[model samples]
Target: MAGKFIVIEGLEGAGKTTAINTVARVLNQHQICDLQFTREPGGTPIAEALRNIIKNGLDNEPLTNKAELLMLYAARIQLVENVIKPALKIGKWVIGDRHDLSTQAYQGGGRELDRIFIETLQTQVLGNFKPDLTLYLDISPELGLKRARSRGQLDRIEQQSLAFFERIRQRYLELAERDNTIVTIDAAKSIAEVTAQIETTLNAWLTN
Candidate 1:
C-alpha cells in the first residue's frame, strides 16, 4: 500500500506541534514507523528560501498580496515535486506541518484575496494533490495569539491583527465542515484532553 499524507493545521498557537507528536506516536503504535516530515513553503532549498521571504520581508520591500500568494504556490509546488511526492512514491508516510490548506485559510480568507484566483492557482499548481488527513486544531484568535505571544516574538504573519486570525479560523472551520478528511479538535481544552481527542480520532481513522 502507498504511504499516506497527514497534515496538522491551525492558527499561530493552536498546539499543532503537540498534535503532530501525538499523531506520530499513534502511527508508531500501529507499527507504521517509516515517516517523512515536511513543512509548507519549505522542505527544499528553493521552498525554504521562499518561506523566509514569506515570513520576513526582503530589503523593506512591501510584498503585495498577489505576489505573496504566488510565492506560496511556487514554494508548494517545489516541495511537492522535490520532496513530498518522492517520499510517498517510496512508501514513506509524510507528516506535514502545514499544506495548501494554510494558504486557503491565511491568504484566501485572512488576506481577503479572490477565491477564484486562489482556486485557479491551486488547480494549476497542485492539481489533485492533498493530504489524506488534516487535523485542524480549532481555537479562538484571542486565546491562540495570547499563547503565541508567550512563546516569544511574533513572525510577520503572526503579527497580523486579531480580525485577520478570526477570518482564518472561520475559513478553516468552513472548509473542515465540508471535507470528511478534516477533523476539527477543540484546542482550548487541557493538553491531556487534546491529546486524547487526537489519539482517538487518528486511531479510528487508521483502523477504518
Candidate 2:
C-alpha cells in the first residue's frame, strides 16, 4: 500500500515544530512507525540553499515578487521529487512542515499574485499530487508576530507588514473553507490545549 502524506501548515511561530513532534508521537502510539519528515523550501541540499536565499535578502537588488514565487516553487519541487516521493514509494509516511498551501497564501494573497497563475503552476509542476491531510494552525497576525519576534530577528518573509499577514491569513481561511482535506486549528490556545486538539484529530483520522 502507498504511504500517506500528511502536512502541517501555519504562519511563523504557530508552533508547527511542536505540533509535528506531537503528531509523530501519536502516530507511533498507533504503530505507524515508518515515517519520513520533510520541510518545504528545504529537505534537500539544493532546496536548502534556495531556502536561505529566499528567507534572507540579497545584497544588491531586492528580490522581485515573481522571482520569489518561482524560487519557492523550485525549492518545493526539489524536495517533493527527491525526498517526499522517494520516501512514500518506500512505504514510509511523509510528514511535512509546509506544502503548496503556503504558496497560495503567501504569493497569492500576501504578494497579490494572480490565483490562476498559481493554480496553473501547481497543476503543471505537481499534477494531482497533494497531501492526504493538512493541519492548518490558524493564528492572529499580531500574536503570531509577537511569538515570532520573541524567538529572534525576523526573516525576510517574517518582516512583512501586518497588512501582508492579514491577507495571508484571509487566504488561508478561504483555502481551508474550500478544502475538506484541510483541518484548521486555533493555534492561539495554550500548548497543551493545542496538542490535545492535534491528538484528537490525528487519532480520529488514523482510525477512520
Q: Model 2 over residues 1-208: C-alpha lDDT tens digits?
A: 7889999999988989999999899989989899999998899999999899899967857999999999989998999898899899988999999999999999999999999999999998899999999999999999999999999999999999999999999999999999999999999999999999999999999999
- Candidate 2 lDDT for residue 35: 97
The alpha-carbon deviation from the true structure for residue 3 of candidate 2, after best TM-score superposition, in angstroms, is 1.0
Candidate 1, residue 102: Cα displacement in angstroms equals 0.6
Per-candidate TM-scores read 0.99, 0.98
lDDT tens readout by residue for model 1, 108-201:
9999999999999999999999999999999999999999999999889999998999999999999999999999999999999999999999
Stretches of model 2 off by over 4 angstroms after superposition: none
Supply candidate 1's per-residue lDDT for 175. Answer: 96
RMSD of candidates 1 onward, in order: 0.6, 0.7
TM-score of 2: 0.98
Instruction: Give the lDDT of residue 58 in candidate 1.
Output: 96
The whole-model lDDT of each prediction reads: 0.94, 0.94
Enumerate clash totals for all models, in the order shown.
Answer: 0, 0
Q: What is the lDDT of residue 55 in candidate 1?
A: 95
